[model samples]
Target: MDFYHESVLLKETIESLNIKEDGIYLDGTVGGGGHSSEILKKLGQKGLLIGLDQDIAAINKSQETLSQISDNYKLFKTNYENFEEVLDSLNIEKIDGFLLDLGVSSFQFDKGDRGFSYKVDAKLDMRMNQDSSFSAYDIVNGYSKEEISKILWDYADEKWANRIAEFIVNARKTKKITTTFELVEIIKNAIPASARRKKGHPAKKTFQALRIETNNEINILRNTLDRMIDRLRPQGRICVISFHSLEDRIVKDTFRYKFLDCICPKEAPVCVCDKEREINIITRKPITPSEEELKNNNRSHSAKLRVAEKI
Candidate 1:
C-alpha cells in the first residue's frame, strides 16, 4: 500500500517552526514524510532532519519519499516516547526545532487491514508497531466493562460508553469479538436510534478509544512533551498538532506550566522557590485548520496546532 497522508496544516505548521537554514529539526511523528518533506525544503545542505515513526511501513515509505531530496538525516522505526534516547544516541544534545503530529495517520485508517477505521471491516488490530504484543482485540475481549467504559469516556469522550461496554462484555461472553465489523455492529446496537441518526458515525468514538488504549497514546504524549521541551536549544521552537481535545489539553497545560513555572505564593511573593521559566508559549491559543483546509480534508477538522519556544 502507498504510504499516503495529506499533511494537515502543512504550510501553517512549517511556518510556525521558523525553520533555520542550517539548524537541526526533528519530526517526531513523521507519517508519510509529508511535513518532513516541507521541512527539508527550507534547509541548507548543512541542515539536518530526523524523521521518526513506530510503523515500519511509514519508515520505509517516508524514507523512499525523502531519499529523492536529501540524505543529510536519519529515520527511525521507533516510538516517539523514546525520542530523547534516540537523539542522545545520535550525539544530538539539542535541536533547533521539533514537530509532533499526534494521532493515527491516514495510512493506518486507509489500509483497512490495520483496523483503525470504524467504516472498515477487518481484524481487531490497532498496534502502531506490528511487533506490539497487545492489540484492540485484547482490550475489547479481555478488559472489564468498567475499564472499557473509562477508556471510552476519557479518551474519546463518548457519552454512551457504559452501554457500549455492557454490549461488548455481553457479546464477548457468547463469542470472542475478533473482527472490526462485529464490534461495529455491537456498537450500533448499543446506541439509541436517535443517537445513531446524529451527524458523525456511531462507532467513531469507541474505535478511537480502543486504538488509543491499544497503543498507549495518551500517556506517551503526556510523558514525552516535557522531555522534548528540555531538548530544545535556547530560542528553539517546538510545534505540536494534536487531533483530540484530550491531547490538546495536555499540550496546552504543559506549555502553560513550562512558561509560568515561578510558583511563588501570592500571599508571600518573595520568590521562595527557585523554579525558573523554561519556554515561552508562542501561540496563546492553538491554531486550527482553516475553512479551506477543512473543505479539502475533513480529517483535519479536529487538528489543533500549538507552538512554544525554549527560553
Candidate 2:
C-alpha cells in the first residue's frame, strides 16, 4: 500500500517553524513528507532537511515525495529518539528548526494490515517499525490483565480499563485474541451498550492504548524532548503536533519546566538553583486545526500544535 498521511496543521506548523533560507531543519516524524515538502519549498539551495521515521514505508514514501521537490533532503529509518546519534554521525551541530508530529499516521490506520485501526480486521501487529520484535499480539496475548488495564488507563485514559482488561483475560482463556476485529469485539462486549453509545468508537481507546504500548510512543517522547530542544541552534524553533491529550500534556509540561528560570524551592528567599531558561514557549495554549482544516481532513480534528524557540 502507498504510504499516504494527511499532515495535520500543515500551515500552522510551517509558520511556527519560521524557517530560515540556509539553515538546517529536521522533520522527526516525516510521515509521507507532507510538512517536509512545504519546509523544503521555503529552503534555499544551501539549506538542509533531515527526515526521520521508524517506519521504512514512511521513509521510502518521504524519500520519493521529497526528491520530487528537491534533492537537498536526507531520509533516515530511525526513531526520533536516536536523532542525536544521527546528527552527530553526520557531523551536523545544531538545527535551525525541527518538527515532530506524534501519533499513528493515516496510512498506518488506513492500511488495515498494519492493525492500527479498530475498524480493521487484520492480525494484531501494530509495530511502527515492522522490524521491532514486540507487537500488539505480544501485548494482548501475553501481558497480564493488570498490565493491560494499567496501559489502557495510563496511555489512553480509558474509563472502562478494568472491565476491558477482565474481558480480554477471560476471552483469551478460550483462545488467543489474535486479530484487531477480535479485540474490537471484546472491547464492545466489555463496554456497556449505553456507555459505548456515548462515545465515538467503543474500541478507539483500547486500540490507541495498545498502539502506544506496542511502540513505546510516550516514553520516547518523554525522553527525547529535552534532547531535541538542546539540539536546536540559538533562537531555533521546535514545533510539535500531538494527536491526543496525553502527548500534549507531556510536551506542555516539558516546555513549561524547560522555560522556568529557576527550580529553587519557594522557601528560598534568595536565588539558589541557577537553572536558566532554555527556550521561550511560543504558544501558551496549543493551536488546533482550523474549521476549514477539520472539514477537509477528519483525522486532523484532534491535533494540537505547540511551539518553542531556543533562547
Off by over 4 Å in 2: none
lDDT of 1 by residue, 1-311 (tens): 78889999899999999999999999999989999999998899999999999999999999999998888779999998888888998999999998999857788998989998888889999899999999999999999999999999999999999999999999999999999999999999999999999999999999999999999999999999999999999999999999989999999999999998678888875877888899999999999999999999978989999999999
TM-score of each prediction: 0.98, 0.98
Model 2 C-alpha RMSD vs. true structure (Å) is 1.0
The superposed Cα distance between candidate 2 and the true structure at residue 210, in angstroms, equals 0.4
| Cα-based lDDT at residue 55, candidate 2 | 95
Judge candidate 2 against the unseen true structure and give its global Cα lDDT, from 0 to 1. Answer: 0.93
**Regions of candidate 1 where Cα sits further than 4 Å from its true position:** none
Error of 2 at 267 (Å): 1.3
> In candidate 2, what are the lDDT values of residues 1-311, reduced to their tens digit?
78889889999999999999998999999999999999999999999999999999999999888988888888889999999998998899899998999957889998989989888789999999998999999999999999999999998899999999999999999999899999999999999999988949989889999999999999999999999999999999999999878899999999999999999888989878889999999999999999999999998888999999999
Local distance difference test values of all predictions, in order: 0.93, 0.93
